[model samples]
Target: METKVAIVTGGNRGIGFEIVKGLCQKFDGVVYLTARNEERGQQAVKKLEELGLKPLFHILDVTCEKSIEDLAKHISTHHSGIDVLVNNAGILDFDKAISSYEDAKKLIDTNFTSLLTISRILYPLLTNTARIINISSDWGLLSNIRKQVWLDRLVKDDLTVEQILEFVNEFLNAAKMGKSAFFSIAGKYGDYKVSKVAMSALTFVQQRQFREEGKDISINCVHPGFVMTDMTKGMGDFTPERGAKAPLYLALEAPQSLKGSFIWHDCHHVNWDD
Candidate 1:
């Protein structure tokens, strides 16, 4: 039998760490916990080891294509391919008063663009029944925009990946020109929200591509609820373990028939049209 393997990016802490632990306990194969920092990543693995759960460690910086490519080559060489992938890596710059174009680019690149890059690289290595979960936020909902015109464009089923990239680029460019508030819906956390919206859009596009290619892969995105993490300054109603539940479900138990859907943390289908 072939060795089954799973990879969880940004798994050194918080929800990602919990997801790695869940996979280590439940998955019948090896689980790799990836972090950008080697010391932190190895420490996370050591903590899991204390629990008798063996999770390997890898250094991954989603913002760098070289880092993503290196991890892909390592996995392909060692495990033949990947059975599960949880794209838990993401960022949220909470400085509402800071609106630098460079920061905006970083936010979108880490949260949205880099995901597409990694997915593109690792997709070919996915097995027949593989599952891919993209961790998203409810803030990406169409309702957040408040403008019917922009909301319609985003929720439209026919929206293409190229169009989504164009949309994000437009926002970033506008921000660079000192018009960060140019969009009606972006408000303060414009960069973070726009990045997640693009991620949601990418989920739909990839799902359609997979179907067109006749693959049995399951790909979905979910809002992991507002959890207590460093990103939230440790202020949230839910724990990190609770936040991991939704992504873990989408990665493992979700039916193949449930592809391309945006799911709430409670595991219900979200009405993107609303």
Candidate 2:
């Protein structure tokens, strides 16, 4: 039998770190804790090792194609294929120092576009029955899209990845133009919300495509809850460990039937259209 392998991005700290720890304890496979900074990534791995948990370190800047491809090549050479992937790298820049458009562009690029790029690039390396867990947010809920037309498009059972991309691009263009209307469409935390919403929609589209192609892969997006992390400015109700629970469940133990769903931190399936 081939050795099982799991990859967790942004694993240097917070929820990503906890997910790595959990997988190290429970997953009967090699768990890679990837981060953009080599030093921090190695440090995190060493810390886990001190706790008597084994986790490998790799440098992965999700926004960089070369970085992603290099990691993909490494995985292909070292393992038969990937068994689980957790897309946990993201940013939340509410800093008033930057312009709103700049912030929006950065958020979309890191949180949404990078995900699409990495998934497309590494998709061929996924083994049958592989699990993909995208770390989304409560803001990803379809209800956050106040515009009925946008909601209708996203909720379509036959929604395509192209459509999701178009939706994201439209928001980007609007943000570029400083369109307050588009910002209102997603309400507070507009850029972050739209990016996550796109992620959740993409999850459904990917799962549907997998089914149509007769692949055994499972994909789901999750809201890790408002965890107290640097991204949240340390003002959330849950801790990073609690935030990792749902994502860990989906990656290692959730039923395949749970594919394409948006899940809460408690592991309950959330109605994406609701």
Candidate 3:
């Protein structure tokens, strides 16, 4: 039998770190904890090692194509294929000190676009029954998209990834042009919310594509809830450990029928269109 391998991007800290720890303890395979910074990734692995839970570390800067390719190449060379992938690397609007347009671009690229790029790059390396869990947010729900037309387009069962990409590009263009109307449509944390909305939508798109391609891979997006992390400025209803529960469940335990769904931190299925 081939060795099962799992990877968690942005796994050096916060909920990502907690998920890595959980996988190290429960997953029946090698768990890799990936992060953008080599030092931080190694440090996180050491922390888990001290806890007597072994998790391998790798450098993964989600926004960088070269970095993602390197990780993909490493995985292809060392393992049979990826059994599980947790797309958890992301950023909040306040995490950077750039202009609004630049900030919005970076946020959208990191939180949303990187998911597409990394998945596409790693798609060939996924095992037949692989599971992909995208870390989305409640803000990603279509309800956050106050515009009905936008909601209608995204809620379509036959929604294509191209449509989702176009929607994201439209939002970025609006942000660049200072269109307050677009901001009003997305409401608070506009850029972040839009990016996650795109991520959740992409989940459905990928699942449909996999099904059409005759692959057994299952993909789902999750709203990990407002966990107390640097992203939330440490103000939230749950801790990192609590936040890790649902994602960990999906990664290691959820039934394959759970694909293309938006899940809550408690593992409840949520209607993404609502």
Using TM-score as the yardstick, the better of models 1 and 3 is 3
Give the per-residue lDDT of model 2 (tens digit) for 163-215: 99888887777777765755656766778888999999989988989999999
- Which scores greater on lDDT, model 1 or model 2? 2
Cα-based lDDT for every prediction: 0.85, 0.89, 0.89
Q: What is the lDDT of residue 270 in candidate 1?
A: 90
- lDDT score, candidate 2, position 131: 95
Q: Candidate 1: lDDT of 54?
A: 95
Query: On residues 152-242, what C-alpha lDDT tens digit does candidate 3 reach at each position?
Result: 8998888888899888887777777665745655866788888999999999989999999999999999988889998888989999999
**Ordered list by lDDT, greatest first:** 2, 3, 1
For model 2 the local lDDT of residue 222 reads 95
TM-scores of the models, in the order given: 0.95, 0.96, 0.96
Per-candidate alpha-carbon RMSD to the true structure: 1.5, 1.5, 1.7
lDDT for 137 in candidate 2 is 93
Which regions of candidate 2 deviate over 4 angstroms?
95-99
